[model samples]
Target chain A: MNVILSLIVSSVAVFGLVVIAFVGVWGAHLEWLFGVVIPYLAVITFFVGMIYRVVQWGKCAMPFRIPSTCGQQKTLPWLKRTYVDKLDNPVGTVAVVGRMILEVLCFRSLFRNTRLEFGNGQEIKYKSAKWLWFGSIVFHYTFLIVLLRHLRFFTEPMPFFVPIIEKVDGFFQLYVPTLYQSGLLLGAAATFLLLRRVIDGKMRYISLPADYFPLFLILGLATTGVLMRYVLKADVVSIKELTMGLVSFRPVVPEGISVLFYIHIFLVSVFFAYFPFSKLTHMAGVFLSPTRNVSNNSRIVRHINPWNYPVKVHTYAAYEDEFREKMIDAGLPVEKGAPEPAKPE
Target chain B: MYDGGKIIAGIIIGLALLTFPIWYTSGRAAPKPEVKLPVKEKECVQPGPYMKKKHMQVLDLWRDSVVRVQQRSYVAFNGKEYDMSLQNTCMSADCHAKKSEFCDRCHNYTGVVPYCWDCHIPPKEKPEEKH
Candidate 1:
C-alpha cells in the first residue's frame, strides 16, 4: 500500500509538471516564463538550497567517534589491519577518504550490499545485489555524461572536451541525428532502478515517495528529450540562442522552439527545485554522513564529546544504604556485612 | 529537540538568495535579441527568422560540405542556391559589410564565440560618416 501510494503520488506530480509545461507554454504561450524565468528560478533554488542543506548538516556534531567498521581494525603491531574498513588516525583518515572517494565514485557500499532470502524455505541465504549497484553507477555516470554533452549547446565555439566527448559519444555514427550511448544507458538504468523498486517486495516496502519521484521525473525528462531529438525535432540554433542568452544573463525566448523542448526544460526545472529538499541530496549528504566520513580508533585514542554536560549521580554508598535489606534478602552482596538486613523502611 | 529556528532561518535566507535574480529584475521585462540586416538583399539563401534560428546548423552543413566532403554549392531551405565558400558567401556576398555591427553584435550579446572568426579574417570596420 505504501509503495503504491508512493508511486502514485510521484507519478501524479510528474504528470502535473508535464501538463504545466504543455498547457502553460504551448497553450498560453508564456514562452519567456517557461523558457527563461523558471529555469533561472530553478537554478537559484538548486544552488542556494543545496548550500544551506550542506552547511546545516555540517553544523551537526557527532558525539561518538563511530565509523561503520566492516573488517578487522588496526591493533597491536602483529595484527593485520583491514585498513580502509577500520580507519584509525591520519593515515586511516586518508584511507577513509579514499574509501569515501570510492563510495562516491562507484557506490562501493551499494556494490557490497547483500540481499537475504529463503534458500530452502527453512534457512535464510545472503546473495550479492550487484545489479542494483551497477544500475546506480550507470545511471549516475551516464547522467553526468549527458549533462556534459549539453554543455555543447550552452557554450559557444564549444569547449575543447565537449567536441571530443561528442565525437566519442557518437563514434558509431550509425544514423542521422547520431545516437549517444549515455542517453540510452541512462534510460536503461533508470528503468532498471524503477523496475527493481516495483518488483522487489522488500525494496518496495522500504521505498518512499522521495525515491520514486526522482526516478519518474528523470524518466519523463529523458523521454521528452529523446522525443525532441528523434521524433519531433527542435531548432538547434534557437536552442543555442536561448541557452546562450541564459548563460550571458540575458535570457531571450527565440521564436519557433517546440513545445516538446519546453516540456523538457520545465521538467528539468522541477527536478532542480525538488532536488535540494528531497533525498536526492544524497549526492552531497553522502559526503557528510558520519558513518562513512569519520575514522574509528576509540580504543587507541580517547574519544570525547565536546558538548557533553555534567549529570548528577547517586553514589554507591547511597545506593547500598537504600537497598541493603533488599540486597541481603536477595543474596546479593551488601557493602556492610549481612545481619543489618533488619532495617524497616 | 532539533535547532528548528536555525534551520528555518537558513531556509529563509536560502530562499531569499534563490529569488535574488527576480528581485533585481522586478518590474522590468526581458528584452528580445535584435539582429540588424543589410537594407537591400541581393538574395538570401533562407528567410530572416530561419537564418536567426538555424545559422549555426547551416554553417555546420556548409562546413561538412566544403571541408569534409569537398562540395562547392548547396541549396538552402527557401530553394535558393548559395556558394559553399565561407569567405565568399558570408563575408563578401552583400551579407554584411562590417561583421562587427551585424554578426558580432548578436553573437557577443548572446555570448556565443563563433569558431568561423578563429580561422577566417574578420571584415574591416565601416568608417563613421562625419557631417
Candidate 2:
C-alpha cells in the first residue's frame, strides 16, 4: 500500500513538472520565463536553500562524542588494535581520516553492511549486502561525470580540461554521438536502487515517497537527456548560444533550440530546487553528521558539552560560611572556626 | 530549543544573497549595442538578424578555421569570399571603423569578457591616411 502510494505521488510530481514545463514553454511561449527567469530563480533557491540548511545543520549542538564505531575500541595495550574496525583511534587521526575517506568515496561502511538471512534456532547467518554499495558508488561517480560533461555549455573558450573530460567520458564511442559510460551506468544504478527498494520487503516497509521521488525524477531527467542526445538531434549551436547568453549574463531566447531542451532544463531546475530540502542533502549533511565526523577519543580527551551550563554551584566555602557554627557543632571539620558546645546538648 | 528569529534572519540573508543578481538586473533589458553601417560594404557574411543573434558563434568558427584549420578565406551565405582574419574582416575600412562604439557597446552590456583583445590589438585609433 505504501509503495503504491509512493509510486502514485512520485508519478504525479514528475508528470506535473513535465506538463507545466510543456505549457510554459510551448503553450504560453514564455521562452524568457522558462529559459532565463526560472533558471535564475532555481539557481538562487538552490544556493540559498543549500546554505541555509547547511548553516542550520552546523549550528546544531551535538552534546555527545558519538562516533559510530563497529570494531573493538582502544583498550589494553596488549590487545590487538583493529585500525579500521572502530578501534584504538585508528593509529592516530590519519586512520580515522582514511576511514572517513573510504566511507565517503567508496561507501566502505555500506560495503560492509550485513543483513540477517533465514536462520535456524541454532544458527544465525549474516549475509553481505554488496548490491546496495555497488549501486550507490556507481550512481554517484556517474552523476559527477555527467555534471562535468555539462560544463562545455556553460563556459567560454571551452576550458581546455572540459573537452578532455568529455573525451574521456565519451571514450566508449559506442554510437554515432559516442555514448557516455556514465549515462548508461547512471540508468543501471538508478534502476537497481529503485527496484531494490520496491522488491525487497524490508526496504519497501521503510521506504517513503520522498525516497522514490528523486529516483523517478532523475530517471525522467536522464531519459530526456539521452533522448535529446542520441534520438532527437536538437540544435546544438543555438543551444550553446543560449547557454552562453545565460552564463555571460546576457540571456537571449535563441531561435531553433528545441522544446526538449526546455523540458530538460526545467527538470534540472526542479532537481536543483528540490535538492536542499530533500534527503539529497546527505551530500553535505554526511560531512556534518556527528556520528560520522566526530573523533572517538573520549578516553584521551574530555568531550565537554558546549550547551551544558551550571544552574547553581554550591561550593564548600559558601556552605562553610553559611553553616560554620552548625558544621562545627556537628563535628564536621571547619576551616577557621573553633567548635563550641551546644546548649541543647 | 529553536531560535526562530535567528533562523528566519539567516534564511532571509541567504535568500537576499542568492537573488541579488536577479533583483539587480530587474527592470533592465540586455544592453543592445548600436549597429552602424560601413561605408565600403553594407552586407555581412550573414543577414542582420543572424549576425545579431550569432556573430559570436560565427567569429568563433572563423577563429578556429583560420588559426587551426589553416583556412584563410571565408565563403559567406551569399557565396562571397572574404578574408578569414578578424583583423581584416571585423576592423577593415569597409567594416565599422571603430571597435569602441560598435563592439564594446554590446560586449560591455552583456559583460562577456572576450579573450580576442588579449592577443589582437584594436583597430588603430584613426585609420591610416590612404597613401
Candidate 3:
C-alpha cells in the first residue's frame, strides 16, 4: 500500500510538472506564469521549506549518548581509541566532521563497502563494491558544479570565475559543439545509480517509488537538455530573454523559446519545490542528524534535559532505617537503631 | 557450506537480473538521427543592421530554419509543433551572427546566463568597422 501510494503521488507530481511545462512553452497565453511566476514560487518554496525543516529537526531532543560509532570507546588511558569513529572530545568531534566531509563529498563510506559471499565449496569471500560509490560521487559533484555554474543566470555582474569554469568544463572539445563535462557525467552517474538500485536485489527490495521517480524525472530533464544543445537547437537569445524576465520578476514570454526548454525548466522548478518535502530533504537533514553531528562526551559533562520535571526522591538509607531489624534478621547491614530501641518507640 | 554457497550464488544471480534493465535503459530507448550541419552557401550575401527591415527578414529566415529543424529533430510534449522562430536570438559570436544581436542586448541588460556560450564556439571576431 505504501509503495502504491508513493508511486501514485510521484507519478502525478511528475506528470503535472510535464503538463505545466508543456503549457508554458506551447500555450501562448500561459507563458507569463510558467516563465516567471512559477519559477519565483519554486525558489521561494525551496528556501522557506528548507529553513522550516531544518528548524524542526533542530528542535528534536536527543537525551542519550547515541552517536553512531565504529571504533573503541574512550576509557582506559593506555588503550588507543579511534577519535573520528568514536567521538570522545572536541578534537575527536572535529576529526569526525572531517571524516563526514569526505563521506559526503567523496562517498568514502560507499567506497569502503564490500559485498560478502560464499564461493566454490562454500568458502567465504569478500568482493569490492565500488560502482555505487563511484556513481554517487560523480552524481553529487557534477550536480554541485552545475549548480555553481548556473550562478551566471541570476547575477547581473557576471562573476569573473563563470567564464573560467565554462572553459574548464568544455576543455575536452568533444565535438563541433563543445560538450559540458558535468552534463555528461550527471547523466552517466544518475543512470548508474538508478541501475544499481533496480538491479541489486537487496537495494531493489528496499527501494520505493520515491527512488525510481526522481531518477526518471532527472533523466528526462537531462535528456531534453542535451537534445536542446546538440540536436533540436533552440533559439538562445529568446531563451536568455525569457530567463532574465523570470529572474527579474517582470516576465515577458519570449516568442521563440521551444517547448522542450519550457518542459525542462518546469521540471527543474518542480524539483526545487519538492526538495524540502521529500526524501531529498536529506541534503539538509544530514547536517542536523544527532547520530552524525553530536559529540560523544557523556562522561565528561552532564547533559540534563532542560525540560525534565521535578520528581520525588527516595534513598536506601531511609529504607534501611525503617526496616533495620528486618534487615539484621535477614543477614543484611543495618543503617539505624537496633530492634530493642525500635520496640520501645 | 554447500547451502551457504548456493545462497551466495542465488544472491549474485538475483542482483545481475535486477541491474540489467537499469543499464539497458541508460541511453535513449529509441535512438534518433544526429543533426546534420548546414551546407555552406557560397555567396556572401550580407544581412542588414540588427532589427532593420531587411535584417529582421533574414533573422526571421534563420529563426524559421531553427524552428523547422527543432520540430523535425525532436518531439514536443502535447503533440504540438514548437516554432523555434519565436524564441530569442543571440548577437554574440557564440550563436550565429546574423540573428544574435537582439539576443545579446537583452541578455546583457538583464544579466542572464546563456548556456550556448558554454557549449559552442564563439563567433570569429569581425574586422574593425570603417568610420
Candidate 4:
C-alpha cells in the first residue's frame, strides 16, 4: 500500500511537471505570469518552505550520537583508530569536510557502488558500476558552469570574466557555427543518467515515476534548445529584449518571439517551481541535512537533553537504615543498635 | 542455469540496440522549407497591398527560386565579412531570417550588439538543395 501510494503521488507530481514545462515553453504570450510572477512565487516558496523545514528539524531532539561514520573511531592512543570518527576534534572535522567535498563534487559514494547479480553457472558476482557516477558528476558540474555563465544575463555591466568563460566554452571549434562544449556535455550527461534508470533493471525497480519524469522533462528542454540552435532558428533581438525585461522586472512580451522560446523558458520555470516540492529539493535539503551542517563536538562539549525531568531520589544508605531490623531478623548484619529488652507497647 | 527469462531479456536488449539509431535519426529529419527569394536581387522589397494580400504565394515562389540558390552563402556576427564558403554561420543571430543578412553585415561590421541567437535557429544553407 505504501509503495502504491508513493507511485500515485509521484506520477501526479511528474504529470503536473510536464504540463508546467509545456505551458512555460509555449505560453510566451503569458510571459508576465510565468517569467515574472511564477518565478517570484517560486522564490518565496523556496525560502519559506526551506526555512520551515529547517526549523522543524531543529525543533526535533537528538539525544543520541547518530553521525554516519566511515572510518574507525578514536580510542586508546596506540590502537591507531580513526581520529576523525572517535575524537571528532577540529582537525578531524576537517577530514569529514574533505570527505564531503569529494562526495558532493565527485559523487564518491556512487563511484564506490557495486552491482550484485547471478552470472552463468549459478555463480554470484559483484561488478563495479561507475558510469552512473561519472554521468551525474558531468551533469551537475556542467549545469553549475552553465548557470554561472547565465549570470551575464541578469547583470547590467557584464562581469569581466564572462567573456573569458564564453571563449573557453566555444574552444572546440566543432563546426562553422562554434559549438558550446558544456551545452553538448550537459545534454549527453543527462541522457546517460536517464538511460541508466530506464535501462538498468535494478535502478528501474527502485525508481518511482517521479524520478523518470524530471529526467524526461529536462531532456525535452535540452532537445528543444538544441533544435532552436541548430535547426529552426528564431528571432534573437526580440528574445534578448524579452529576457532583459524579465530580469529587470519590466517584462514586455515581444510580438515575434517563437513558441519554441516560450517552451524553453516554460520548462525552466517548471523546474524552478517544482524544485522545492520534489526530490530535486535536495538543492535546499542538503543545507538542512543534520549530518552535514551539525557540529561533531561530542567530546569537547555536552549535549544535555532539555526534556530531562526531576525525580525523588533514594540512596543505598537510606535503604540500609530503613531495613536495619529486617536485616537483623534475616540473619544479616545491622548498622545501628541491635536487640533490646521489650518495651511497653 | 540456461534460464529462458535471461535469454529473453538479452534478446530484448539486443533488439533495442538495433532500433536506437533509427529512432535518433528520424528525430533529426529536416525541418519544413522556409520562404526564399531570388539571388539577383540585392534588397528584398516590401510587396504592394495587392501583392501583400497574396504573400503566401509570393513566399512559396521566392523560397523555391531565390533562397534555394543563395542558401549556401554564409555571414558572420564579428565585425568582419567573410564569404559563406569560408566561414559557416554557427551561433550568430544576425542571419536568421531573410532580412537577417543585412542586419548581420552591418552589425558584424559595426560591432553593434544584438541577442538574436538565444532562442532562434542559427542560419544554414538548405541541406537538400546542396547538389
The sequence of per-residue lDDT tens digits that candidate 1 reaches over residues B4-120 is 564457556756754443443443433444555776675567776656555666777887888888897888776877788667777773776667667766654433455576588
In the range A185-228, model 1's lDDT, one tens digit per residue, is 99999999999999988788888888898999999999998887
Docking class of 1: incorrect
**Residue A7 in candidate 3, Cα distance off native in Å:** 7.5
Q: Where in model 1 is the C-alpha error above 4 Å?
A: A82-91, A120-124, A310-345, B1-131
Cα lDDT tens digits for candidate 2, B1-131: 24356456655775675444345445343333354568778798998766755666677788778889998888899999888877777788778667775776554433334557758887876446421
Tens digits of lDDT, candidate 2, A50-140: 8878777757777777887776777787876655555324535676667668777887768888888878876889999798898999999
Residue A188 of model 3: what lDDT?
93
Cα-based lDDT at residue A88, candidate 1: 31
Candidate 2, A342: how far from true, in Å? 19
- Residues A1-345 of candidate 3 have per-residue lDDT tens digits of 254465576667777778767865677557667767787798779877876776565556666756666666667888776544353232255666775576566766678789898999979899998878878888988887776666545444455666677668878756434578999999999989877876776786787887878877888778887887666666655665565555555456767667888787888877788888888988766655566556667787788875678988778877787787787889886656575645554
The DockQ-derived docking category for candidate 3 is incorrect
lDDT of 1 at A227: 82
Q: Write the per-residue lDDT of candidate 4 for residues A1-345, one digit (tens) a residue.
A: 233464466556655655664565565356566656665676556556654554455566666445555555554577675544442322255666665565566676688778887999989999998887889889988887776565444443444566667667777645423467888999999888877766777676787767866776677667777766545655544565565555555656766666777667766766666665678867645534456434555764687766678868887778787887889889987666665769989
Going through the candidates in order, state the TM-score of chain A alone for each one.
0.86, 0.91, 0.83, 0.76
lDDT of each: 0.76, 0.75, 0.62, 0.56
User: Candidate 2 at residue B57, lDDT?
Assistant: 64
Candidate 1 matches the true fold with a TM-score of 0.69
- Shift of residue B74 alpha carbon in model 1, Å: 13
